[model samples]
Structure formats: structure tokens, C-alpha cells
Target: MRAIATPGGLPISDPAALVDVEVEAPQALPHDLVVRVEAVSVNPVDSKVRLSANPSDTPRILGYDAAGTVTAVGQEVSGFAVGDEVYYAGAIDRPGSNADYQAVDHRIAAHKPTTLSFADAAALPLTALTAMEALEDLFHVGANSEGTLLVLGGAGGVGSIMIQLAKRLTSLRVIATASRPETAAWAREMGADEVANHHDLGAEVLRIVPEGVDYVLSTHSEGQIGAFAEIVKPLGHIAAIDDGNLNLSPLKPKRISWHWEFMFSRSLFQTPDIAVQGRMLADLATMVDAGEIRTTATQYIEDFTAAGIREAHRRIESHGTQGKIVVTR
Candidate 1:
């Protein structure tokens, strides 16, 4: 199998940061599906791992989002077959989807939406899963939920899908934060009821919702902890996906319920409800087919070579990309 991998932690500008290699195709485990990968998307985690990973004799494959066809199925796999087309954010512990073939747990993979091409479907898994888990599991939002929800980093991959999911699945009035004019328009296109400039987050959001929002989903929660505390309503829930040295004392006075949402948690821990990812993805497919949601793939590269992969990573590292960037074979 042909794959792109990082030799070790190196700068993206370095040619050795990502290289092409030939390796044996992976085989399916008892509950796994061996997929023939067709397309993949690059996320922030890819760059983080590439930079932070220690140097090793063996190169590490580093893709999480993939859309592919199942070429073989493990003995215990039930919902998927050899010919099924699937999409998933493969477990972080295993070799990732930046290869010709990938072995993924069937419990976390779902049939790709029939309405989308492989490139488009590839863009959804990781971001969609993050948004879905943050809203449904962490925040406990549903159809009857009526409140103003604020989304930070609203034009990024996860936030793009988050806005659409909130609008389609729940009655929550969504206020998304985007600093630039283009990003604000993109957020509105994704179904955000209002767009606030993240540069002045507290003031911008408070201007729109004077009483403060009922929930906050912080996609890029680096230095905005204090702003989140000031803008969110008392007793409201706050969910964050990013990791940093957070000073959480500000939210303590308001009794705010803080939640950390990591989409890989269930698969990483082999949780009892790990299969929920597959089920939720299936439901998302139904929604996609029904036109309730749209793919967030804003940038597409037809080349799937190492250079192409490197360019995708560079774009993600640029920190200015809107929505997802996909690379197809």
C-alpha cells in the first residue's frame, strides 16, 4: 500500500515533514473493516501530531478523516460488508487513513452519504463527529431545547457543521463568531442566526444577545476563557474542544457547567457506547441525503500525492482556512 507519513516532528516547511512510502496493506481485526481509502481530509490534529510527535525509526501515518470502500470485513463486523462504502474518523492509536488501505473499527464507521462524492464525504467525518458529540452528548441539546447558543470559530470545519446541525436538529438560536467578513458570511450560509466578530467576542455577542447566550461551544478556546465566562448566561453549559492551560476560575462564580468534548474519547477508550459513533454517523447520512445538512469541504485537491498532502497540512497550519480541505486519489 502507498502512504504518506511523517518521519518525526518537523516543520511543515521541511520536505521531510511528510514523505511517500510503500508499506504492506493493513488487515482487519475481529471487529474491523479494511477499507480501500479513496479520499481524506486534513485537520488541526494532523499538524499537531506531526509537530509534537517524537522522532522514531518508523514513520507514523497521521490522517483521521477518510471516506473509502470496504474491501474486507472482520469476522465480528455486522452492519458493514466487503463492498460497503464508509466514512469515519479512525481511532487515533492506529495507523490513520493517509494510505491506500486502512483498518478501522466497524463500530465507529458508517456508510457514506449516497448524495456526496468521496471527496465531499471525506470532509465530514471528523468535524461532523466533533460537532455532533459536543452538541448532543456534552451539551444535551435537542429539538425542544430553546436558548441562544454561541459558537466560537464559526467558519472552521467543526463550527461550520455545528451551525448547520444546531439549526436543523434543534430550536436553539445560534450566534456564531467569525472575525472576517468572508467567514461571517460563511457562518450565515451554514445557518447561523447571527454572526459576531470573534476579535471582540464579548462585546459583539453581548450586542446581539444582551442577556448572554445559554450555551457556548468554543472551537478555539485559547485566550477567550474570560470572554466566554462574561458572555455566557449563568448556569449555562460550556463545551470546548481545544486543549490549553485554561484558567477556569472565572466560570466558578456563575456555576457554569464546563464540558470538554473530544470526539475520539469513545473510540480511544473503547467505551461501552462506542458504537454510538456509527449510529450517529448513519443518522447524519440520512440528514445529508434529506438535504438537512451540507458538506463543509471548502477546499479540494485532486492530487493525493505526498506533495498534495503536505500542501493540505500547510493550509491547515496557516490557521485561515474556511471549512474543510480534502485530498482525493
Candidate 2:
């Protein structure tokens, strides 16, 4: 099998950051699927791991989002077969999808959306799961949910899908934050009812909804916690996916609750309900096929080699990409 991997903690500009190597094919473990990877997408976690994970004698594979065909299934797997087409964000503890073949736990994998191509399907798994879990599992928003919801960093992969999911699944009025005109337009295209400038988050959101919003989804929460506290209504909820040294005192006075959403937590911990990821993904596929949701793949790269993976990492590190970037074999 051909794979691309990082030597460890090297800058993207270094040619050694990602390298092409030939490796033995993986075999399915009990409750796992050995997939022949067709397409993969790069996420911020890929870059973070590349820089922070320890150096190893054997280079580490870093991709997470993948769409592929199952070449073999574990003895205990029931829903998938050898010929099934599946998509998933493979567990962070395992070797990743930037390879010709990968072994992933079948409990977290689902059949790809029938309406999308491999490139498009590859872009949905990680981001869609994050959005779905944050909205439904964390915030507990549903069809009966009402009030305004604000989405921070609305043009990025997770935010793009979050906007669409919130609109289709809940009655909450959606406000997405985007500093650039192009990103603002993209946010609206994804079903945001209003667009606020992320550069001036508090003022922008206040102008649109003077009473403050009921919920806040912070995709990039580095330095905006204060603004989030200011714009959220009392007793409202805020769910964030990024890691930062956050100060919670600001939200304390307002009685606003803050929650952290890490999509990899369930798979990483082997939770009892780990199969919910597969189930949610299956539901998302049905929605995609029904035209209720759309893929967020804005940029596509056809090369699945080391150089291509490096370029994809560079783009993700740029911090300005509008949607998901897919690299197909």
C-alpha cells in the first residue's frame, strides 16, 4: 500500500513534513473495516497533530476524513460488507486515511451519501459529525427549538454544515459570522438568515439581534469568548470545538453555560454509544440524498501523493479557506 506520512513535528515548508512511502496493507480487526481509500480531506486537527505529536522511528499518518470502499470487514461487523462504500473520520489513535488502505472501526463508519461523489463525500464526515453532535447532542436543539442561534466562523467546514443543519432541523433564526464578503455570501448560501462580521463579533451580532441570541456555536474560540458572553442571552448555551485558554468568569455572571465539543472523544474513549456516530452519519446520508443538506467541499485536489497532502496542509494552515478541501486518488 502507498501512504503519505509525517516524520514528526516539522513545518509544512519542510519537504520532509510529508513523504510518500510504500507500506504493507492493513487487515481488519474484530469490529473493524479495512477500506480501500478513494478520497480524503484535510482538517485543522491534521496540522495540529503533525506539529505536536511525538517523533517516531516510523512516520505517522495524519488524515482523518475519508470516503472509501470496504475491501474487508471484521468478523463481528454486521452492517457493512466487503463491497460496501463507506465514509468516516477514523479514530485519532489509529493510523489515518492518507493511504491506499486503512483499518477503521465499523461502529463509527457509515455508507457514503448516494448522491455525492467520493471527493464530496470525503469532506463531510468530520465536519458534519462535529456540527451534528454540537447541535443535537450538546445543545439539544431540535425541531421544536426556537430563538436565534449565532454561528461563529460560519464559512469554514464545520460552520458551513452547522448553518445548514440548524436551518433544516430547527426553527431557530440563524446568524452566521463572516468577515469577508465572499464568506458572508457562502454563509447565506448554507442557509444563514443573517450574516455578522466576525471581526466585530459582539457589535455585529447585537446590531442584528439586539436581544442577544439563544445559542452560540464557536468554531474558532481562541480570543472571542468575551464577545460570545456578551452576545448570548442569559441562560443560553454556547458550544465550542476549538481548544484555548478560556476565561469562564465572563459567562458566569450571565448564567450562560459553555460546552466543549470534540468529535473524536467517543471513538477515542470506546464509549458505550460509539455506534451513534455511524447512525448519525447514516441519517445525514439520507438527508443528503433527500436534498436537505449539501457537501462543503469548496476546493478539490486530485493528487493523493505526499506533495498533494503537503499542499493541502498548507492551505488548511492558511486559516482562510471557505469550505472543506478534498484530495482524491
TM-score of 2: 0.98
Question: RMSD to native for every prediction?
Answer: 0.7, 0.8
Candidate 2 per-residue lDDT over residues 86-168, each given as its tens digit: 99998999999999999999999999999999999999999989989988898898999999999988899989999999998
How many residue-pair clashes does candidate 2 contain?
A: 0
* Tens-digit lDDT track of model 1 for 158-228: 89999999998889999998988999999999999999998899899889999999898888788888998
- Assess every candidate by TM-score: 0.99, 0.98
lDDT of each: 0.92, 0.93
Q: What is the lDDT of residue 221 in candidate 1?
A: 81
State model 1's lDDT.
0.92
- lDDT at position 318, candidate 1: 94
lDDT of 2 at 205: 93
Model 2: lowest-lDDT 10 consecutive positions: 219-228
